[model samples]
Target: MKNFILFLFLFFLTNSCFPAIEKPDDYFYAINKKVSAVVDEPEEVKKIYTRELQKYKKYRTKKYLISSKYVELSLRKKDKHILVYELLKLNDDKYDYVSIACNYNLALQFEFSSPELALQFLNKAIQLDERSGEKYFLPHLYHQKGRWYYNKKNYKKALFYFNECLKNLNRKETLYVASMHNNFGLCFDKMNNTKLAIEKTRKAINILENKPSKTKEERLFLYFIKGNLGGYFFKLKDYSSAEKLLSQELNFYITENYSSEMINPSKQLFELYTITNDKEHLKKLIDFLKEGESRLKTTDRIEINKIFQKYYAGINNLENLKIYSARLSQLNDENTSKTTQELSETSDRLNNFIIKNINQQYAYQKRKNILLTSVIFLAIITFAFFILNIKTRNKRKHDSLERQKMILENNKKMLEKDIKLQNEKIKSLYHSLNLKIETEKAFLNSLKNIKKQNNFQTEEVLKDLLLKVNNLIQVDKRNYDLISECTLQNEYFVNRLSEKVPNLTNLELKLCMYFRLNLSSKKISSFENTTPNTIRVYKTKIKTKIGLDRETSLDTYLKTI
Candidate 1:
């Protein structure tokens, strides 16, 4: 009985000392932490957002749920627009701003279904934020409203909301500040304030880069800013700077298979290449364009046509050049015609709205009895007409959606095709490179034999042959060629090493690069024109400076990087 009582006491004490494990669905405050993610299923989403979110209010999860899946419910061709409606039904005095965020999110998802619906939700978000007496989500609410106006091309109004976003963002809110600066940059770009746009984008980049930990979305924003910087540099006619930024972005996009975002960067690079007379890069640009021709929008095709126009002209191929020029002109003409047609349709709609409103007012005052009878009789006929009109509109929308889906599907296929072509080209280039190297070796061998056959008397002939061989076999000039190429190739390795060992000199940096390439002590010594013993001393110094122990494999560590 004593033992049992003691055991029960111990168990209770242990339970009191350590808190219970948090359930997966338990609510947790992310006060100082970044946002958490959303669940995938609708039932979970409803339980979390519709019920749990309202229960905890603004002090709970600031974003309610951070899922791109929830965002995607707003896009696409189908007509399921229930997310916002479901969220709006949760509005109450206690959790006003929480409900407000739901409304804004709903607006964002179905902004395409109706502009009025989006505006209605946006206004509700603002109103709820004002009434809640908490600035918890005011910045985010302002940002979303800015986006709405920005999408509508209302630059001034967008700036108003963006400025509001900035005011609420304290210095410690680096994420919000970075986002605000980024959107402000986009606004400035759209308004044609190129200088401000560049400044804002660079500010955003600086802010995000300073953060110790960045999410994938933050890194993507950095990539986008770099690409935007490239565009701005292109506008300023700084081709060299533009080429560097755009090329880095293009390389990332191609390697990561981000085909949707590749089009503009590719076009910008093409423009830079055309002007710089870089036929090698220009040929690559042409390949990318041709491979994506079916997927290109009017603007994309126009840009590509311009590139071909320059390429053929450079080669003095007049016939092909003329053909491309005609295509370019045709694309431009078609774009203009489409723009005019859209404008005409918009004007007709406005005129019809005005006339119908005036007739409704006049008929009510001028002939009340007759108008009433007519409205009653026409109501039945109008109901049937309304049903038919809805059917027709829905069918048209469905067809349009199908076309869009087909275009995207075709784009994916084209991207895959281009990737295959690129791989083949790389293989062919590798073969050509090997052939060139072999030919150079044979040529050098021949030179040696010829010199020997001539009794080796001609110093000038021997000197010329040696110089050509030195140019081909660049290891002797290791600092100039091998180290530079290695540095460019293993950027992450170089960057990490520099950060770890900031005091490293130029020679020490070279030692690190050699280590990164898994070069032996003897090979590194030979490259540095030194003895193996001297190379060992350098390696020890590097390992010590980088805080790695003797047993740690420096080369293996670099390989992981």
Candidate 2:
């Protein structure tokens, strides 16, 4: 009894002196902290994340539950479809915006593949943030929305969203800001604002280059921006600077074995070599191209083959030129067919998704109507029992229910109309794509026939053949259907303009319609795949033809007409 009392006393004394460390039931947060610390090292981040995921078979917190699955799904190297479906399955409507990880990530997955779908996800995230009154992720979300517009080729909208993104940022000197500038450069480049493109890209490069202890991702981005700056220089005919920058980029990509990235620098260098007649560099680049032929995509292969054909033609190598010409024609046909098929499949998927959404909404509406009816029945019964003599109250309640029913009916009709319009748009787009494919096939067949002609062997003959192909393609006529549709929507604006000018060409009429839509010269150039300066010259010609004074605004005048 004395020894037992002594042992109990010792145990109690020891427990009081040194307390045990308590482990958290929700230990995933701790693992998350560690993962964040080593995020710059992808391998270590993956290892730590995998270990924590395996250790925790079930997460105790909502945020970690979604976050862990996000990490796991990302590590699996899944495509956008699988990522979207899996992440959406994990989303709970009851959870707060901060607790859900799928919204932003799913937006990223859809950004490149289906920008329309990506916009919906981005808008959902923004809505959630607004509902929660939280501005923490607003900047990132705005940046993503800007990317969505950028992918859709709506540079003006992209710039608007990017400006919003910058406005929300707490710090201007960040990787995100650098990324924004890089995006602005790309947008400006597409708009044929090469000088502005160079400025923005240089700003991005300066920001990244000046950062101390740069991360691997940042360094890679800097290389990409430099390569893009080189492209801008190439556009400006600054061959010396372009060659220097592109060479460095090519070396970086080669060392990293980035096959897809290799194509851009290679393409630019090939063009530069052909222009400068640099046979020495051409031989070296040709070797790289030959080695990487199997890895390049069909479209890229076609592009390089054309370059080779041009290079060989310049050197009077008839045999090699003919070989490349044949290869280019065949590759063009194959790529056209493949692209057409892919577009058809994409259209089908989009239609199915839209139809599925409509069906879901219809079902939801039916359920809502049933529930509303039940509530009204219960309310009427209660009113009857509580106020049997109050006929006015009963009448008012009945009128209110009728109004609600009318509102629901109106909403349902509007939704149906919207669905109809959307389906029509999809069908129109599909038809246009098919039309383009047919036109390209015709153009390619014409080229093949021209090449087979005995008279096509001379330089002048080849030049004439290219000019004939250019005339035969009828690019302006190809876009006429789209313009016609726009005209119909704009109250026959094209027809009205043609009547008013009486001397307007088809292209000038199209330009007038574009101006009437309030499109900028930059936007018009992008649409026509021409330079802004060329578009400006066309604008001048239109003003002269329309008999407008120099002081009058052409776009504003067209809008009035």
Candidate 3:
């Protein structure tokens, strides 16, 4: 008994003296990375929580870190109540990382349920992250906020946030930058600047292509961008490019069993084939659509039926056209009947409430009159007042409901009419422009002019074509101007940098100048016609040549020089 007591005391003393060591920053970072890597593996994530996170429960900073990770995992699993509970438990002022993570995670959670709530959380996250000054997740937060604005159809605000995201991202975050460009494309697409939309989307593709993907998610993201680009191409009537891109995306979706995603490419193909009078492609698309009919929403089904009606009518297939017309009418009636039934139910409820109120008032009035016959005048005055109040209240309620119903109907009609007008306008513009054929014609005319003027002088022809190409691609002049401006502004800085790092190459010197101007590797890569990864390598080499330690920031160092 004495030995046992002595051992317990010693154990307690040892534990009290040592306690559990707080995890270093590197350990925390590694564990965070590990959790992210195994997030898709439920068993692995469970093991991580049990073996690693559970041990740190008593430490405040580490505890919050674990809680943040749990919240993130809960979000992925869509465990809403648990996520909310965890978020509520977190002390936002206790740790900046935890606070930012909580707000960001909660914002994502609220995005589908309440966009306003999502915006509030997102703004808080941004504010806190910015104030913290580390900016580890600032760009991602910006992108999420941009996505929120995009979903709300505030394309201008979405673009602003997306541009901010792009401005803050570095070359190392290639995938994120690519996503922001894709968002830019989406915003431009919504704003009806299809040309600019196509430009941004192509740039996104180029960036993704230059950076090899290491995961299925990244590849899928690339395909998603391609699909959007294909739609943009279709809008611009570049049917060949559109056909190729859409076809690839359709095959990918079918193979991946992404039935919902399959509808978009299928619909675009159906329209394309009908417009081009390609019966072959139309029949194939029809087969695909019929096979996946159960996967489509009612709106999608109605749209597909309309497309079929147009196609069959165009081909003079009267029987098929009649069949599709019947289907379309039935679908429309079904959709309309749902709304009508809802309105009828609402009206019935209001009538029932009014009747109930009247019956209650009648019962009370009868009791009052029976009990107060001796004071009949007073009773009459009280009953009149009661009846007048009820009537006035019911009248106000009835008027309010009627006004709301009328307003809703008016808004619905206006929205439908506006959509119809917009669709008509787009179709007219597409038919009138015929951009592809017109552009080809213009180029051919230029070639003919060159042939006639130069009389087949090969050198002159080449020179003229070169001049036209240069005129078309005028971005180089802007780049040169920027470089010149940067050089002039940082002349003393450049001299200091050159004196400090005398062996720097021309490319390295240029990179230093760009760094001084705070240009990201992505932007510098564009100017240099090289990959961002290569620019990053040059940056590291510059840091080494300038004798900056690993802990020192190259950007800050260059600024000081």
- List the global CA lDDT of all models: 0.63, 0.67, 0.68
Q: How accurate is candidate 1 locally (lDDT)?
A: 0.63
RMSD in Å for all candidates: 32.5, 41.1, 35.9
State the RMSD for candidate 2: 41.1
Off by over 4 Å in 3: 1-29, 56-72, 75-82, 212-214, 255-257, 291-561
What is the per-residue lDDT of model 3 for residues 192-231, given as tens digits with 9 covering 90 to 100?
Answer: 9999999999998898888755455456667777888999
Which number leads on lDDT?
3
List residue ranges in candidate 2 displaced over 4 A.
1-68, 75-90, 97-100, 130-137, 169-174, 291-303, 322-561
Clash count for each candidate, listed in order shown: 1, 0, 0
Best by TM-score: 3
Score residue 311 of candidate 1 by CA lDDT. Answer: 77
TM-score for predicted model 2 compared with the true structure: 0.47
Task: Put down candidate 2 lDDT per residue, 218-336, tens digits, no spaces.
Answer: 66667877998999999999999999999999888778776666777888999898888788999888877777777878877877787777777677676676667667766766755
